[model samples]
Target: MTLQTLANAALILILVGWIGIRQLTWRPILVGRMWRLPIVFAAIGLFALSGSHGASSVTAVDAALLSLELVVSLGVGAAMGALATIRPLSSGDGAPDAPRFESRTGWVGLALWFVFIGVRVGIDVWAGALGSHLAASTGVIFVMVAANRVARTAVIGLRVSRLATVAPVPAGAR
Candidate 1:
């Protein structure tokens, strides 16, 4: 398979593995403090690898565009993440339940992911397939968005499950 195909396959495998692990493991994996460092490192490593691949594949013009896209995407994602994090913090209804946060953040993340993906695709189509660097950059953006959305959804579900486990039910409610 080509590099693009290989990249796509690897992304799919990572997604599936994450889901499978979450489903099969009875105990909470990320709940432990030790897992935090490793998870962060793994994320960094993945980003590095993907960034290297994207840099190596694109031309200089495309690279610049891609870099700008990366910055904008990351800024938007960070803003959203912060917004999601802050919403729960601001609510005076005691500590926010993890499941509720997970569900709310998950939907928001998914919506943002879809919007970004759609925008990238729309831009590419509008630019036409006339062998332009913008088209190629948009393609890369699309792939990155797909990978991110999958990872985000998996994490969201895991958080939701953990929150559910610890959540208290109403006294009279069954």
Candidate 2:
């Protein structure tokens, strides 16, 4: 199969990961573990990167684009992640680290997720149609998944940290 096809297939998989993520309800997503969606995204991101890099020799412009993608993706992802509805819940043990949480952005969150996905798909389609190597570049797909995960996880972590600080002590523990 052609490299472009391989890369596009990989790009399509990223959308699958996002769909799975959207199905989830925000409940202590990162509290005890990395969770399935992000893990899937990471694995998928890495796999796509391998396809992008192995497909051909990367150029300086490709590297620059990758860096730019990273910056934009991360910035956008961070904003989206921060926008996620994260709030602490009372865990059974009442442990500081064991934060119970929930997330919901309603229509806005879904719209944002779709917007990012649409843009990524559009880029992949446009580049692949022209046989531009950018379509096969690892950076584009990698940033799409990695940066979003970073932002969401960071937001969850930050919110959890804030909650831990002000949380009232559990009855017996206090």
Candidate 3:
């Protein structure tokens, strides 16, 4: 439909593909692949810029607020990613067959990006500048995050169950 809606849909698809890639490969597709993430981010940025309502209404205060939101979201996401990355390593767990998905930290990065979209949508809505464009963009962000996390959780649960089923029983059996 609208450019914003299209952009949002593209972002959601990217996130889904990102998660699947991580789960199946246990690594980020971007790492030596280089140009991919940058290309995707650039495309999304261009889409957002093109559909944005313009900077006429973005006062210094609004800019500051958006900046703060971005910083906080990024910080939180980075912290989470770092924590997730370090957990298995620090636990002295034997090395995995392949490095875990933490190689690129894409999940946290995507979360931060969604947070930015949320703040932008909130600001636009508050300013009465929202239309179908903003609504669609925001809706896609929310839906994608929710759906992706749910899928991840389900996958994790299934993996755990499968592992338990295959693990050998201890000696001294009943």
How much does each candidate deviate from the true structure in C-alpha RMSD? Answer: 9.6, 4.3, 11.3
Identify the candidate with maximal TM-score. 2
- Candidate 3 per-residue lDDT over residues 35-146, each given as its tens digit: 3443455455556545556533455554554455445444543443442331121122233332222233345644644564465456545433432332233433443334
* Sliding window of 10 residues with minimal summed lDDT for model 2: 23-32
Candidate 2: list runs displaced more than 4 Å.
1-24, 35-40, 51-56, 95-97, 137-143, 168-174
What lDDT score belongs to each candidate, Candidate 1 first?
A: 0.43, 0.60, 0.42
State model 2's lDDT: 0.60
lDDT of 1 by residue, 23-51 (tens): 33232222233235335544654565465
Write the residue-wise lDDT of candidate 2 on 78-155 in tens digits. 666677776545445655555456565545666666666666666655555555575445555754666766776677
Q: Model 1: residues >4 Å from true position, as ranges?
A: 1-58, 85-103, 126-130, 133-143, 146-174
Counting clashing residue pairs in each candidate, in order, gives: 0, 0, 0
Clash pairs, candidate 1, are: none
Model 3 regions lying over 4 Å from their true place: 1-10, 13-17, 20-25, 28-39, 50-53, 86-174
Every model's TM-score: 0.38, 0.67, 0.39
RMSD value for candidate 2? 4.3
Residue 119 in model 3: lDDT: 59
Best candidate (score: lDDT) = 2
